[model samples]
Target: MAEIDHIVLGARSLEEGAAFVERHLGIRPRPGGQHLGFGTHNMLLGLGRGVYLEVIAPDPAQPDPPRARPFDLDDPALRQALEAEPRLIAWVARTPVLEAVIARLGHRGGEVVAMTRGDLSWRMAFPPQRQDMDNLIPALIQWQGEGASSRLPDSHARLLQLEGEHPEVDAVRAALAERGLEEALKLRPGPHARLVARLRRADGVEVALASG
Candidate 1:
């Protein structure tokens, strides 16, 4: 029953990411809730139909816990990634069954990690190391249902179907089918991370924001 809930623009700074979005799409994003445990914060733009887009970066103001950071922000590679270019580093999709999705998701980099990121109670099943960023996919989620995003009004932005240039796109679809995942979320595993969102702006012109 779940589809693509959001796209994430993994940036080094919150303002930089939001500005990139505003310049490209001509819409200002609103401040989303904070994830103190994740060591990150985000600004949000409604993508209509209960979906959204996020501009995320490490929150330097948060207290540094004695233990390791919860989200991927602490990872040096991700840090360097933003330093190089604040672009679409990764995106997450919601799954009804957390454990089941983890099992089926063909992440070549070992098992997924079960970690809590503040108010967001979810797990990030990414590559164990930084080198796998090229092949690393998305974090499947089973959100902590608390009406956090339930009451938000979504600005209707039409999402056109996705197109993939990778050869393994069929395999990816077949794998999802094997796992009982939906076909509505068209994704193709590729070398570079980019968000290909086909949406109509408020002015009724169809455009795709490469920012994710």
Candidate 2:
């Protein structure tokens, strides 16, 4: 069965992204390394169990990527949207048999791309055109080893739920079911595409992180 590996929060800059987490969750995220080819870097916050939160932004120190950056970071509209606030942009699901799952889903997930960050590496399957399925669909990942979640420090935040909002909730649910993730995520009909995650802090405060 597939499981959620991480949730992605996108920002115009890493500084801005980290600040958003600190301001809302009352915790700072640990530094994560850069994606060399992708020209991006991230900060990580462990959300208990094997799930984590990733704050990602383009690395100003790096040259422009050869192709468009992942998660539509290069898109002007998305960049403008992120200027207002850091938002939940994407999520990843881990599967051992990535190829079989891709085949089973009839190729909704794109070709597998090998990605590395320092000593960590994984195979990621992005969706076709990168925006199909209203961006409600999750990218698929196959970790090379134990994965980064095990090495992260606990951020004292417990992920209570992760859900999706879309106009076509039934179709999204069916796709998740095909990937064996229907039980892991709940989809509800809404006017737009969005991700909503509820996290409980150590002090008994619950916060909802939503893409808006």
Candidate 3:
């Protein structure tokens, strides 16, 4: 099955997004690796297993980053909304069939691209979009090549669940399918339609979904 590799946080700017997470979780995120193709960079936190939390924003310094514009930078309301409500943007999965996934996405009226930061030298694949954001869809990523940093500190916020609203739920599911992500993941929402994630930390036990 396609294992969830990360939970993405999309934002117009890193300065803002980083600050938001820190304020809520009371933990500052460190500067993460870069994505040359998508013109993106992020900060990361290990949630569990290989799964991580990535706060992604467009990087202007990249020379060959994607030609995408980025998120709703022009909309003042969008920025304000994000500053007030920094919810989970999406979730990613790791698959052995990276090429096959890319091909399927390309065929299904979507584009896929991979990027590597020269400074840190790590690679990640993402969903194609005109802007840096992909219509609230999870960007698929596959770790490639060598020198990848699996470093993460345990005993942090445990994500017990991640639930999407009515229309958004359907949209995300379809997007994953269009990008060729079925059969590898059992991500279907049940009658409760809640993403139940069990998180255990020194603080106490917590849950993300209601019925979990």
Candidate 4:
């Protein structure tokens, strides 16, 4: 069965992202190397165990990517939204049998692509276009060995729960169940799609990062 891996936060810039995290979570994220071909870079904050948060932004250091940037960073709508503040855009699920999971999800699974960041390598199942399900459906990842969280510095924060609301809640529930992800998120029906992650800080305060 697949498990919650990492959550993605979209930002206009890495500096802005780090500041936002520090303001809310009271800890700054550490630099995570750039995705060479994806034309993006990130900072990571450990969420205890093998889960973490990834703040991703366009890499001005690189030329435009051959393809559209991941997490819809190139989408004008998303870019405009990020101009205001970072958002909890999406999450990823890790599993050993990525190909099998992809086959199970069919079109919803997206195309499998191999990618690298520094010496770490992995394969991911990403949507061909913009993030699907309003970025509610977790992207699937298969790391070569240990995942990125292992190498990340502990931030004294731990993810406590993940929740989502969407117009088509039943369909979304069925899709997740097919991928053995039904237990990964607490889902409900809403006027639109949105994700929420609940976390416990070192000071024992519970905070929420919501997609808005």
Question: Using lDDT as the measure, which candidate wins?
Answer: 4
Write the residue-wise lDDT of candidate 3 on 23-116 in tens digits: 6555666778666555677887666556666777767686643365333333465456556555455566666666676666564434445455
lDDT of each: 0.59, 0.87, 0.53, 0.89
Q: Candidate 3: list runs displaced more than 4 Å.
A: 60-66, 69-80, 83-87, 104-106, 118-136, 145-149, 168-202, 205-212
Candidate 3 at residue 156, lDDT?
A: 70
- Model 1 TM-score relative to the real fold: 0.71
Clashing residue pairs in candidate 3 are 2-184, 37-66, 70-131, 70-132, 160-197, 160-208, 161-208
Candidate 4 residue-wise lDDT, 1-212, digit = tens: 89999999999999999999888898999999899989999999999888999999999999999988887788898889899999888899998999998887787789899999988999999754533678878888999977899998888898999999999888778878877899999999999899999998878899999988
Model 1 lDDT tens row, 95-184? 667667656555542365554444556555553444233322345556656322454466555556533323455554553454344455
Predict model 2's lDDT versus the native.
0.87
TM-score of 2: 0.96
Ranking by TM-score: 4, 2, 1, 3
Better of 2 and 4 by TM-score: 4
Which ranges in model 1 have alpha carbons more than 4 Å from their true place? 63-85, 103-136, 146-148, 163-171, 178-182, 185-195
- Cα lDDT of candidate 1 equals 0.59
TM-score result, candidate 3: 0.65
Please provide the root mean square deviation of candidate 1 (C-alpha atoms, Å). 4.2
